[model samples]
Target: MTVISTGVYPIDKLLNGGIEKDIITSFYGPAASGKTNIAIISSYNISRTGKKVIYIDTEGGFSFERLKQISKEDFDNVMKNILIYKPVSFLEQRKSIFLAYDYIKNNSNSIGLLVIDSISMLYRLEKGDEDVNEVNTELARQLQVFSEINRKYNIPVIVTNQVYSLLDQRDKIGIVGGDLIKYWSKCLIELKVYENGVREAILKRHRYLPEGLSIKFKIINDGIIEYKE
Candidate 1:
């Protein structure tokens, strides 16, 4: 299958050519670890190739200023092809995601990327009020929808997730969506802040990449770049 370039050289090299198409890839990290940056840049890169992108933003982190910084002259055109949906609540998010999936399945020839920036934000917020069984059921349904779309249309699905520290395992962290997210995702990447502005991406789980492998990168004005020693 074909791969979509993330527009970051080191990342592309790490993945052996960039993100693989028709799979669910997730990025999990604490705040300010540059998860959103990678998603935006990858979406922008895919849009640059004359294909459309469906971006579902749950945290209101989609920054036009940042996109302009990365794309410069192509920003306006790129934005045109990127269909963005900002869903405020869990119900709204689910609706938006399914709607996008339906649209893409019908217009499969035009779309190349599907992104959900922080997929678990609204789910986490609503979990307190809802029953545990209901939450898990909803999450499972959502993942099933994503998987179906990916397999049918051959479109890459990239999602960002929040992380919580594991109290017993001090060095380990768990993603918000728990095992369902872990099971559905074919590629799982974890990001950490190394310094003031530098961040590192750890390939925690991938079909090919060994666990514990890491690459250092920084979020610059033009998006993510490989960090230099």
Candidate 2:
């Protein structure tokens, strides 16, 4: 099946058996909203199949300790199938994506998923120094590469994004890259923080699922699980 379970029951169910392949799936929210946790858990799940997961960490949020905790005794084996690339700049992020594409093509059938954990971090950093239009164009170009990879390789591209409050609408949250990210992502999930370590994931957009459906989950040391009151 192209759909892979995210290891979180509620999220898997919400995604109709899990994240779909050959498209972009985005998770975005405020800081500490469990965005990175979801990405890590998804990577762990994909690695369990003995398939490589190309993880591009733009925010240095990829955690080996968290993966070990989630994998338990299978940590060593799971780690083998996950390839990580840390890019410190937006330009490097672009290069990493290209390298990832080449690596996947050469390996052939070895990779199952591609993840850019907080894909917007480096771009966010570059926004102030670079021309607004130029930076936006570059960001869109990066996403276009992923889109091409998605279509050509039939691999799922998962990205996490940082959120910003809208200027006129202070209550509403918008993702970095705005329409560009939305255009590429077939599934969009908004994470919300509640009391304690609890968080909510709302299915904001999807190909088949109904929108506005939400599930509360908690990030424990081992992994994420459905939260209950």
Candidate 3:
């Protein structure tokens, strides 16, 4: 496993360098919790490094205005290097998996990184309610396809997941996919939104971390700027 720099100082340090390549690193959190910001920034950095990135946007989470935050330099090639595809419906989103898969399969030399803005949209839309049977049947098949791509391509896949509401009234917050999503994801990152303008990201499930360790961050108009404060 190759750990590449996330480009965030404290975050990189926390991951013992960065997230490993050739696997899926899923980041899950609520709406407007800076999840999309990090995705755009990460994609920018990866693409800037001469990697042909395929970004699949599900919830209109990607933006060039946000990309300028990481690097103010001319983004003529960076933006072009990234092939963004927006899938309007749930079925359309699922089809993009194979579309991206085929593109990479044929144009092996052109692909370097792949990102799905939100995986939750597929699961939620398909199974609007807590239908475990539907998820296990359809969701399992969906993840299996991507999992194959992750292992086969040897290129890193960054998937942004959506957080869900907990059934109980406890203080515990959770992501959308019950055990299936949790089990399928190789890396799990949780972002916390505090009342005092403090955003903290926890490296919950990772081979490099000591179970549950976290690093602080803040969200600005630019995006999720890492500030250790």
Candidate 4:
């Protein structure tokens, strides 16, 4: 494992000291699951610590509106070290990510973290609303590139993802593409909103932890923090 830090206590615990540098990390769950917020907060941490961060907005992942909510100091720091690239053109979004990767690689001395706000856009680029084989191939290719960047640069990579639920009357709720995802991620965390308004971060799969451990958490003020429900 490479030396990496997630800056969140519980997440750091799972990674055995945050995250290893140069590894592709993933967080997946339903909509408004707090993955994007956490990724932004994580970028803030990297910025504050005197490292450059590259945020790839594959599908317009960031907003000045959210930054406006942060404290003035944090906002200043985020602006100084962070660069956002939204590629909307002939190359497509997946290629935009690769372009950002190239930017980070060329400026390896300046980059400390690479954040792909949500990787699903990579799939959507090829499929164009059709969630079929074409989408799968592009998505897989992007993940492979993600892994390469992780190993080569030793920079921590965080990718957020949207989930598709399988309609089932049975007890289980099916999540699409996750079975393939587990192969590339070192840790997995899922966010689910319960029927009673309590959101639980289910430790569905972690490489070194128990199967069912969970934490009650919330996203507040554009930041990701933990709390007891």
Candidate achieving the largest TM-score: 1
Estimate candidate 3's alpha-carbon lDDT, on a 0 to 1 scale. Answer: 0.76
Order of models, best TM-score first: 1, 2, 3, 4
Query: What overall lDDT, based on C-alpha atoms, would model 2 receive against the true structure?
Result: 0.89
lDDT per residue (tens digit) for residues 88-192 in model 4: 632466777788778877888788888877766555454566657767766677678778878877777887777765666544454445655677776677767
lDDT of 1 by residue, 125-216 (tens): 98988997898899889988888888888888998999998999978889998899999998898889977688888887888778887888
Better of 3 and 4 by TM-score: 3
Whose lDDT is higher: candidate 2's or candidate 3's?
A: 2
Q: What's the TM-score of every candidate structure?
A: 0.97, 0.96, 0.90, 0.83
Clashing pairs in 4: 22-150, 22-154
Model with the higher TM-score, candidate 2 or 3: 2
Candidate 3 Cα deviation (angstroms), residue 104: 1.1
What total of clashing residue pairs does each candidate reach? 0, 0, 0, 2
How do the residues 1-229 of candidate 2 rate in per-residue lDDT, one tens digit apiece? Answer: 4787877777897788898888899999999998888889889898998889999999889888888899999999999999999999989998999899888788858888899998899999999888989999989888998888888888889999999998899689889889999998999999999898889999999987899998999888878888978
Best by lDDT: 2
lDDT of each: 0.88, 0.89, 0.76, 0.69
Q: Sort by lDDT, best first: what order? A: 2, 1, 3, 4
Shift of residue 110 alpha carbon in model 3, Å: 3.4
